[model samples]
Target: GKNALLLACMRGDLVEVQRLLQSDKADELFFVDSSSQNTVFHFACKEGHTEVVKELLRDNRCSPASAGLFRVTPFSIACEAGHVDTVKVLMDDNRVSVDC
Candidate 1:
């Protein structure tokens, strides 16, 4: 329930991010911030943290998302940010709407 970790993620601080998620109890990774209306997954995708994305997906609790579900999804955010790798990662989830 700490926003600092998610903020670090939004800022793309991989080192701090990992430190915060050292335990990575799935709940930590799945924490969604109402302020940003984003999960850590959304931040990783928006910031193009492809490796983080993969790590997140490895967790069964990491929910599949299409556009932030509030405004933009990870895939849509990645595409908008022009991160091809991140977009590709999102594309791997057939349930996500690439057209969005």
Candidate 2:
């Protein structure tokens, strides 16, 4: 169930992501994929899904700076993946520290 959110983010499916976010299982926004320890936000950033990342960040509970395995934050993942727009989005968030 939560994996669906991660998958949606990975595929850059903004509509599906929005649908999932509005569902009762909104907590899935914070759910980290067990194998990767990456949250939906991380998946979105890594996939260069700027819209998906923006949608995820709209939720207050979605931590902009939450690190997954290897202490890799979404911002770092975005940069590593060459997601300039996603990086810009994350940089705009006050909770995301560039120093991290």
Candidate 3:
């Protein structure tokens, strides 16, 4: 299921993340956990997986502003977890708003 993507991101598995991203599943990109509602991007950011975060963000389907459980955004989670590299990668995206 789409949960695979989230798990891969959480584990910082770049190879798996890349493999999954190549598949034709748009829904996977937006896949959210049942409890946390965290997307692949959210988990990747939270875990400080800079490469995974970069790969996820490169996907046009990835939503940098997407909010998860508790209305937490990927950027916010990254910052909260002190993922400096992840935050920097996200900030590099012009779509990310630090104000949020």
- lDDT top scorer: 2
Ranking by lDDT: 2, 3, 1
Best by TM-score: 2
Error of 3 at 78 (Å): 0.7
Report the error of model 2 at residue 30, Å. Answer: 2.8
Q: Write the per-residue lDDT of candidate 2 for residues 16-76, one digit (tens) a residue.
A: 9889888888784568778778788888898999999998889877888888888988999
lDDT of 3 by residue, 3-60 (tens): 7788889899999888888888746456777788877788889899999988887888
lDDT of 1 by residue, 1-100 (tens): 5566667766777666666666555355567676777777788887888877766666566665734556777777788889898788778876577674
- lDDT: worst 10-residue window of model 1: 21-30
TM-scores for all candidates? Answer: 0.72, 0.91, 0.88
Stretches of candidate 3 off by over 4 Å are none
Query: Where does candidate 1 clash, by residue pair?
Result: 67-72, 67-73, 68-72, 68-73
Q: Deviation in angstroms for 25 in model 2?
A: 1.5
The CA lDDT at 11 in model 1 is 72
Clash-forming residue pairs, model 3: none
lDDT of candidates 1 onward, in order: 0.70, 0.85, 0.85
TM-score, predicted candidate 3 vs. hidden true structure = 0.88
